[model samples]
Each structure stands twice: as structure tokens, then as C-alpha cells.
Target: MMPVQVVGLGLDGAQGLSPVLQSLVASAKLLVGSDRHLAYFPDHPAERLSLSDFHSALAAIVRAAEAGVSPIVVLTSGDPLFFGFGRVLLSHLSPEQVAFHPQVSSMQLAFSRIKVPWQDARLVSVHGRSLEALTQALQQGAEKLAVLTDPTNSPGAIARLLTSLDLPWQYDLWVAESLGGEDERVQQWPLAAAQQTTFAPLNVVILLRQTQAPVLPTALPLLGIPDVYFASFADRPGLMTKREVRVLALGELALPADTIWDVGAGTGSVAIEMARLGPASQIYAIEKTAAGVALIEDNARRFATPQVRAIAGRAPEALEGLPDPDRVFIGGSGGQLQPILSVCRDRLRPGGRVVLALATLEHLAEVSAWSREQGWHQRCLQVQLARSTAIASLTRFTPLNPITLVTLTRSEPSPL
Candidate 1:
């Protein structure tokens, strides 16, 4: 079989082809491409085969090869292997039967125009897939993204989707249209503005996270955050879990939790942190006080974590209507530590962890007894954090109340 030569074309069209690539195209016995590509060579002597859709094009290419067509050429946009038809052709055929001449990918061009490095960025294509993948990446705290959009899933549609998810505040969007062409336009727009504006069908979207953005969406694991970063009630400045204690509790909860419950979630500090740690998971903040609920909502919004949902009402009762959790964090048990632990233990999936952070010995004794009764594995840690303060010209260490964290993991059933 003759080696099918796949040539990558940029927005510069046929004019952008190098001398070597131009000769290869001009000398082809048969050329296969879309009508737009075929239009580039009006006076060429090669027999033109215009086709749309991948399946039909593959079938046509097979027929041409069987017909003894020598020096077949396929025209594609940008780098044929960078989310292009050349990859499909190679998959249907063999590497030895195909040759690729790649141009600069649209993603590369878009990033270059914006004058930013994309080596650390996530690349995605919504050509035929759902926007959920993009949403997931954002929730996971991706700092940079380059998405290829199709006609139905235009830049405006994507913008609308982000705004609908209350994500407009986190990222800056840039739409690069018709690169390398006379009508080329590369413009940056706030996600809100992009939702209302329209762009050409052929475009790439670049999303960059804003500076000092609190939400940790990327793969860099965020363990602990200081108390100063969160909001607290006027009468309770130090009510929330300190960063040191939060980190220890998080380690016990494990990672990639499918479902998480933060019981007695005061101000949702622990809940928000859990959501950040496991962005792909769903986290529920169960709070009894109305003020606590309001604060949880505010903090979740501030972090731009849609996965953290604040539920107002007391638990083991509030936990009734919610989904079972793989990891549970009980920051305040409302003096019902035993009953709450029982409910959480019963609701936890096998191997799931339940972490309780308490300020007293009574709560600790109750949790330890419950763990032994349930035949579950348990671990205990105590955190005593103190911050240094300035008393006059000399530095003084201010002591914080000690906290105890009890971790219980539901043991797997014995083998049959």
C-alpha cells in the first residue's frame, strides 16, 4: 500500500505550507480533505476527493488505496495529531502506511498570542463530549486550561456554563478566533461578559486562574490553611479549627472521598477544607445554628467550591435525608457525641473513615467506646498549637486550647 501523506494546514491556509510540503501536495495522485481544504488548490491536477465525517472519510481513503492510488495526501488543520483527523487515519491504518506533517497546534497558537506559558495547563476537547469534564477540572482547582470548542459548544455556551456554576469569579477567559487569518481576533473577556458575547465557531478558549485565588483547583495537594483565612462569628473569633489540627484530621479522612459529611460544621471551615482536598467528591456541611449555616455558605462561595453544600439543622437528624458518606468529620457533636458517632458509623461505607475533633475528655471517651463496640479500627492524635505574639518589644507565645482528634475506620467484613 502507498504511504498516505497527511499534511497539517494552519489558518494561513495553503500559503503557509513549506516548500517541501507544497511539493508533496502538488505531486499527489489523489488528495482527500473537506471542501474548505479542497478549495485551496483550484487548479491542481490531482484527483480531488471531498468528504465530511470521519467514518466516510476513512472508507473513502480505503477505497482510494485499493484502487492503486499512489502518493495519497490528506489535509488537516494545525497539528494533525493534536486532536485532529490524522490520529484517526493512523488508527484505522498502520504507522508504516501513513506519514504526518504537523503544523503548530491551535492550542500553542492561542497560548502564544496571550503571552503565557501553557506547559502546565490542562488541554481538553469538548468537540463531542459533555462540559462536565471541564467543570470537574475547575472544581479540582486547575490553574490553566485550553479547550477546543465545536459549533454547538461555542465559546459563549462554555462561558454560560461556567457562569451558571458560579465560576465566573475565578478565571479569566480568552477566545482566539481564526488564527493566522486576516479576520483573526484574540480577545480576553471576563466570563460574565463572554457569556453575553458571541465568537466565531472555529476558536480556542484559554482559562487562567486569577492571582492569589483561594480555591486550590490544580493537582497540587492543599493540606492546611491558617485560621485567619476564614470568617468567624463576632463572639467566636477562634471557633473554627486551626490549620494544624485541620491537617491532622484531614490525614485521617483519607483522600478522593466520593461523599463527605462535616457534622456540627461550625462556619464550615472543616467542610470547605475537605472539599478542597477532595474536589471531585461531594461534601455536605451539617450545621444546627442559623448563623453557622450562613457562614458556611459564605465561606464555600468565597472559596468557589460548589461541591460543598451547607445544610441547616442538627445531626443525626439533619444527616437523615442526606447521602451516606465515605468520610465524616464531626467538629461539634452538641453533647450527643455517642449518638452522632453511632449514626455516622452505621452510615459509613466499608473502609470509610469517621474523624472527630473534640475539646474535652468526655467526648473522647465516648468515641473510643463506640469504636471498640463497632469492631472498627481507631487512631488518636492530639494537637497543641500556639502562636507567638509581641508583648511590648519582646515576643510572647500565646497558647491555643488543645484539641483531640479521634479517627475510626469501618473495618472490612471477614472473608467468607
Candidate 2:
């Protein structure tokens, strides 16, 4: 009777095969794998069965076994049973008809290269699966992850998806490519930088969460982040939007926005909030002041919203070179309200929304006029919020600044 074996060969190629496995392969009447794997043993006398077509390869293997072709070896990469074809082969063939020899999996080698123990990591294969697997892993707080990636679901694609999730900034990403092979590459990158990088198609990705859990547990539905959660100018406590107003503005922004721009992003409170609310959105925080820029960066990193890109130039000028936004939040105009409004109106995508957090009536009047001139639908709400404060013997209600939230949306055309 023929003895079928699935030998795992990873990146080490022929050198990784053991002497016993080598002997078995040298004696086999049939061998199967991709062309690259077969190329490793050029002198072997076995009849080659390429894996380009699963049905053809399976038929050939079965026919060989039925004809009593001794020592039939099917070569594969890494651990054959893990996200590999060995599992499928076992389901089709009897245990007595097959045996498996597993080399170090690429996932194992990836973690070894990083010198991190990964017994607890969630092993996800994006080869033929949706990215929702990754989203579920992150949302469930799996701190350590090792992903098996394919050409389509590349490391860059995975990074962008993760960044788009608006997860707290807590992971250090490592890409391990061509493990155990010549020209193997292993590098680490921040999520933002990873989104802009290109990696070899064959790679393993390891994500190590910088911390055990989010510093502030994301309150369900992602709102009501306290003003003190962000880093702001100590003397300018009022610079941030009060939690109540921030939530209202977030509601008006009608989240799950594809793209958002947070103009005058003081301490990035509103921008960060928008990011958390709409994880799939690209949120840009544009601030003109050096201190504001620094604060936005610090807060974005602190909150794990690296997706919230902070620009250091004033609006209208800074807004240049940015993508058309699905939602624009103007919190500080730097007295360029009219010009900023004009640019926002021009850059806003069709059916997009613009929200302005105005402390002054002048800015409100300018925005309302612009909405009218542009023929966009407009709505305004004045948010008056008061929080409880404690004195020696009593709790008193302290009122915060009232903000006028102006929302403008372009009208969808009537049916012809």
C-alpha cells in the first residue's frame, strides 16, 4: 500500500527538510506542491503534481495512491494543519493513508524573530477570509495577534483597516516577511506609518498591544469623554468642548462618516471623539497654533486614534491638499470664518454634512448665510449645559459656555 506524507517546508526550503524526510522524498513515486517547492529538489525522480488546481492535484494524488505508488509526498509550507491544506487532505483521505510532518510555522518563526512569547495570540488567517475577523479580534480586546496574510489582504491593508477602526492607540505592529529565507525582512511600524508602507506579499503580521487595556474604557456607544481626558493648555480649560456639547455635535455629525475634518481642533477633543464614534472615517484635525498642534498629537496618541491626523497650518490654507470631506467640523476659524466656510462648502462631498461649533453669533451668521447662498439645508441648536460642583456642604450646578451647533447638508436632487 502507498504511504502518503505531507511535509511542511517553510522558508528554509530544502535545507529545512530532515534527513529522514529527504530520504522519503527521494524514494517517493509522486510529489505535489507549488512549482517553487518542487524546484527545491530538482534532481528528485518523483513525478511532479503541481498544486495550481486543487481538483487535478487531488485526483492525481488519489490515482497514485490507488495504483500503490509508494512514498507519495505532498510538500507544503509551515505547519500543514494550520490554515493549510493538510486539514482538507485528511478530511478526504483516511488517517492510515496519510501522515504529516510539520516544520516551524511562519507564525511561530514570526514571533520567534520578535522574541515575544505568543501562546495567547489570536491566530487569524486573512487568506480567504473577510477583514471582519480582524475587527472582531481587536474589538474583543485580543492584545496579541498573529495574522496570516495573502497578497490581497496585505500587511498595509490590514494596518489601514485597523487604523480605520478608531481603536485606542495601544499596539506596536511588526511585519515578518519571508521568514527563514534569504532577504527576509522584519520591521516594526506605527499604525499611521504602516498605512503608508509597502510590504512583500508573503508575510506574517504580529501586533503587540502597548498596554493591557484602554486607559479609559470606551464607554458604550463612544461618548461623554470627560474634558480632563485630553491634554489642553492648563489656563484654557474652556478650550475643549464640554462633554455634553461634544456628544450633541457628534450626533449632528451623523457618524460612520467616510471622512471628517476637525478644523480648529482644540486639544483634538472633538476630532478624537469623532474618530471613536466613526471608526471607519478618516479624521483630520487642523490647528494653526503650535501648542494646539502639539496638544492634538499628544491627545491623539494618548487616546489611540492615530487616524486623527493633525495638521499644523491654519484652515483655508491648511485645508488645501486634503481630500473632499464627508463631514467637516469647524470649531475655531481664526477669524477666517467666511473663507473657511467657502472652502468647506466647496470641498464637502455631495450629501456630506458640515457642523460648526460657534461661541459667537458672528460665526453663526456667517455660516448660516453661506448655507443659504449654497442652497444647502441647514439646522442650528443652542446647547446649554450645566454640571454639578461640590462645595464644603453642598453640590451646586455650574453652567458651562453655551455652544451653537450649526449643521448644513447639501440637498439630494429630486427624482426626474
Candidate 3:
């Protein structure tokens, strides 16, 4: 029986193929591939079979080869065995009748052009596949990654997805387009710039995570700043209030308060925002954990919130020495939700607002009961935010922890 030749072509096309592989294609009795792959051997005398249905095409090629076709060539892109059509062909054609000739894969060319080692890199393809693998790697903060792009999951779209994520780690993104071709272009792109720019349809995206701790960002928004800029606990990185929750809490606080208190301040995110909004106001950040206290102090200095004072003690006790607050934000009650509210009730000035960001239903119920018993004017805003992300060519939503921002104001005391 005649052997079936499975040849891998690179972006550079057949002109860059080895003499042996070129000769095999040049003298083929039958050839099979897509239009782009078939276009390379236009002048060849072989009977061309344009591949549409994979199984049907393979069946035809096998029949031709077994019927004494001298040479049957199947043109596929890059390393035929690696994420290529050779695997499918092997499933139907016997190993003895199929020979694989691999070229430089797009992933290999990508890392080579970016000048980064690929031995430890995670290679993923969004071509006709789900994006779960890629999403997992990104969430785990993988060091090096190479992504094969399809027309639907283009470089720009992937870049846009990356920027939208609220992950702690950061990456330097690069795109290698038309690798091994005359019009090849390689570029290191800023995530923001890449989100708006168009890249070639034939491309691979590279992500190299920054090794060093990211330098704290200097340019700050007047209200809510990105959470990545904050230095957080190494053990529990996502312990602080999220940006969406913080934004709503800040609005509820109605800033410019003469004195603002942030109870259970983990990273001082809420306290820092208060200081930013009313730079002249004194911002007190109270925390029970020493590590949290230190983070608050460091984040305070990092964000230029000099007015922020981090108290290294739990609430009810920590609230004793601080002056009466014009506004109070209880981010974490540390299981003392009621006690913290009681302390806040005693110290909060007339017309002052106390906003609590409760993540659990228990905390919400506790705070709600306390507010009603105290007969306080309350307004509650429940925020359930879902961030948009890309899973290959499809867009999916990842839900953030739901939070209820409850605003409380003291009124005439009522029956318990």
C-alpha cells in the first residue's frame, strides 16, 4: 500500500519547506488540505481535494492511497503531530501508511521572537476549543504563557479580557504575528494599548508575569482606585473590600466628613478612599490583626493618605480614643457586628452616616436588626457585580461576592 504523507507547513509556506518534503508535494498523485494550504502547490499536477468535512476528506485520501496512488500528500499547518490534523489522520490511517513531517509550530516561533524561554511556559489554543484551561492558568497567576489565537479569539479581544480581570498579578503582554513569514511583526504591548489596537489574524499572544512586586501606582483617581495598587496580605490577598463595593460605600458615606472611621480595615482601602476624597479630614483605620494594621499604615503612605491613622486593635475598644466621627464605614466586623454598630452609634455625630459593607447574610441580618432596634434611618444597597471575561471566542461572566451596603443614621430611640 502507498504511504500517506502528512506535511506540516509554516506561515512561510512551501517555499520554506525542506527539499525532501517539497519534492514529495511536487510529485504527489493526490493532495488534501484547506484553500490556504492547497494554494501553496498551485502548479503541481496532483489531484487536489479541498478539505471541508474532516472525516470525509480523510476517507477519500485513504481510498486514493490504498488504490495505488503513488504519493498522497496532506498539507497541515506547523508541527503536524502537535495540535494539528495529523492526529486525526492517524486515527483512521494505519501508522505504517502515514508519515508525519513537522515544521516550526506557531507557539515555538512566538517565544523565540519574544526572546523568552518556553520550556516552562504553558501553551494554550483557543482554536475550536473551550477557554477553561486558559482562564484557570490566568487565575493561578502562571509565570509564562503562549496563546494560539483564532479569528474569533483575536489578540485584541484577549487583551481586552485580561485588562477586565481583577487579579492581583500583572503581566507584560506581547504579540507575534505572521511568524516565519515575510510580513512578520512582533510587538510588546501595554494591555490598555493592545485592547484598542488590531492585530493580524495569524498571531500568538505571549504573557510574561512580572517577577518583582509591582511598584505601587502613583496616579490615583479621586474616588475608587484599582485594588491591585494596594499592598495586601500575602496569605489572604483578596481580603480587602472590592472596588465596586468600595465605590458604593464611599457614595453612601457622603464624604467631606470632618472625621471618618474605617472599622476592621484590612488594607485601608475604604479609609484611604475617604482620605483621598476629603484630604483635610482625619481617617482612622482600626484593625485587630497586626499584619492588617501594618498593611493599612503602608497603604496609607503608599496612597499619600497622611491623614489616615491605623489603630492596631479591634473595634469598640479601638473606637474609644478616636474623636467622634462624622462618617463611619464598617468593612469587616470580625464577628462583632452588633458591638461595632453600638460603638459607632455612640460616637457618630448628629447627621453623620454609618455605612456597613456586609458580605455574609449573617452580618446583614445582624446589622439590620441593630439598625431597626436603634430606630435609625437606614438605606440599604445590595450590589451583585459580575465582571465580563473572555472564554476563547465567547464572553462569560464571573460573579463577585455579593455585598450589601447599609447606611444608618441615628434617630429617636425606639423599643428594642
Candidate 4:
């Protein structure tokens, strides 16, 4: 049996085909493609089958092949396997049973037409899928993105999504339509223009991060700001509280805190979050390192959470100056866990709570023992998180360090 040939075509139709591909198409005994795809080759003398339903199309292709059809060609747009129909074909047909002839993908053509290197660009298809991946990518501050869109997930929808993310960085959208065709359209559009204007049905959008500060979104995510948005200490890039751990830590904080003391606040991740949650509340971020104190200020400005006040000095000592706190989060103990808790025990106001994110068993053990000794009300949550990342050609979940959050509140004093 002849290997079923899957030929990829651009919007330029027959004009886009190479001499070799034209001959292959001309020689087919059975041709299969969408209505528009089949219309490209009017002169061909092949049994034509419209490819509407994959299951039904596969049945016809199989029947024709078993009956000794020669040169069976399946037409698709762009590199058929790249977010295209080739993957579906290969799913049912054995690798040996199908041969894929690919054109430059829409993603590829969009990048080239825009004159940018896409080697590092994150590519997502909303053609027939959800926008979850696109949302995640933008929130992560991906420097470049190439999106494949259908009528439903059009450029306008993408423009709306971009504006709604409330990102620290700004992005500009580039829309490319009917690529490789005589009537191809390519234009860079401000998000507003892109949203209001109608575009060619066949289009791809390139989202590029602008260098200037973003016009801050009116509705930024109060929680779950990606760690990338926070500027970290040059020396300790990975030391800051991760979003997963920070979020769990924040939950224990209890909302609408009057005053928050973030002890050993490295890069001020937790502190900034506290400020975001309660913009009117007082937030004092105490960090031992001078660099950490400065970074806290920088991130505070970026997030526009002015309530975050960075105090330079270690805890137990730094706790001396700040007013009594309603909520306290100890992200780093700096080898003074017990003494720090000593201060928290002494100063935490009535109805106050302290939350500790401990990375080591020794610290958890120390915190566990300390809470026991203090006779304070205690609650604990152990968090283990893994994030999916690309490795070579496949995705793998990279595990973050395990974190244990211990929440403590002083029990009402015994009646005198």
C-alpha cells in the first residue's frame, strides 16, 4: 500500500506549492481536503473527498487505500503537524502509513513577516482550545508569544485578554492575516485598535512585551502575581517566597489586617502581597540585608503598594520599632527563629496571628516545639508544589522545595 501523503498548503493556494508538490498532487488517485483546499487544484483528475469530520474522512481514506488507490493526498494548511491536522492523521494511521509534506506554519510566517526571531517565543494555539495556556504565559511575563487563532478566539479576543491581565509590563499586538497569499495583511496594532477593528478571518497574533511600564490594569490579580514580576536580590534570586508558598502564607494571614510585619522579608514578595491585599493597611517589611530592603521598595513602587514599608535590620531587633502587628509572616528566621517568635509572642495584639513559612524540618520542629511551649493555638499546612516546564522537547514538572506553614494565635488568657 502506498504511504498516504499529507501535503501542507499556504493561503496562496496552488501558487504556494513547489514543483515537486504540484506533481505529487497531480498524480493522486484520491484527494482529500476541506472544500476550500480542494478547490485549489481544478485540473487534477482525482477522486475528491471533502474533509469535514475526521472519523468519517478516515473511513473513506482507509476504504480507498485498501482498494489499491495510488498517491492518496490529504491537504492541510501550514505544517500539518504543528498545531494542525497532521497530528490527527498520525493518531489513527501508523507512522509508516503516512508521509507529511509541510509548508511554513502560520506561526512561522507570522514571525518572519514581523521580522523578529521566534526561536525563544512561546507559541500557543487557541484555534480550538482554551485560553488558559495563553493566560498563564502572559501572566508569567513571557517576552514573546505567537498565538494561533480561529474565528472564536480572534485577535479581538486576544486584545481583550491582554488588557485584562494587569501586568507590570506592557504588550503590543501584531496581527498577520492570510499569510503567503496575494491579499495578505500584516499590521502592528495597539490593543485598542486591535480590539475595535475587524481582521481577516485567517489571522495570527504576535504579542510582544513593551519595554516601558504598563498602563497598570485597573483590576490586577490581588493574589497569584507570578514571581517573575518581583525583582529579586542579585545574590539570592531563588530565595524569595514563591507565589504558591506566599499564597498559602497569605491565606493564614486573615484578610483586612490592620498592620502586617513581614519578618526576614527577602525581596519583599510576601510583604508586597500583603500590601496588595490591603492597600490602606500598614505593611512593614523587615529584612536583614540592605539589598533586600531596597528591593522591597523597588517592588513596592512597581506594584504601587505604598503601604509596604521596608525596614532594614534582622527580626527580633527590627520588631522593636514597628507598632504591634495584627498579622505577622516570618518567611526567613535568619537563625533566630525562637527569639523572633519570642518577640511576636510579646507584641502580637489581641486577636492577632503569626504565620511562619518554614523550609526545613528542623525549623518546623523548632516552630512546633515553640508553639507547644507558648501554649498558643496552632494550625499547620505543608505545601509541596511542582510547576511544568519545557525540557528539551517535552514538558516536565519541576518541583519547588517543600514548605510548611505554621499558624499560631495566642489563646485567651485564663480568668484571673
For residue 282, model 1's alpha carbon misses the true position, in angstroms, by 30
Clashes of 1: 4
Q: Give Cα distance to truth, residue 373, candidate 3, Å.
A: 6.5
Please, what are the lDDT tens digits per residue for candidate 4 over residues 1-416? 35589999998888888999998998898899998999998877888999878679888887776666777999999999999878887777678878989998998888999899999999998888777788777756777999998887789888877665544456779999989887799999988887788888889999987644334456768797876577765434455788888888888888678998988888888888888888789999998888888888888998988889999897788788789999899888889999999998988989898889888889988988998898998788989988664322234555777988988989733322
User: Per-residue alpha-carbon lDDT of model 2 for 101-125, expressed as tens digits?
Assistant: 8999999989989999999889998
For model 1 the local lDDT of residue 116 reads 99
Candidate lDDT (C-alpha), each: 0.79, 0.80, 0.82, 0.83
For model 3 the TM-score comes to: 0.68
RMSD of each: 17.5, 18.5, 5.9, 7.8
Clashes of each: 4, 3, 0, 0
Global local distance difference test of model 1: 0.79
At residue 398, what lDDT does model 4 achieve? 51
Q: What is the per-residue lDDT of model 3 for residues 65-121, given as tens digits with 9 covering 90 to 100?
A: 778786788899898888788888878778988888888898888888877889999
In model 4, pairs of residues that clash are: none
User: Which of the predicted structures, 1 or 3, would earn the higher lDDT when compared with the native?
Assistant: 3
How does model 4 fare in lDDT?
0.83
Expressed as tens digits, the lDDT of each residue in 99-158 for candidate 1 is 889988999899999999999999988887767678667545477899999876778777
Worst 10 residues of 1 by lDDT: 389-398
- TM-score per candidate: 0.57, 0.55, 0.68, 0.67
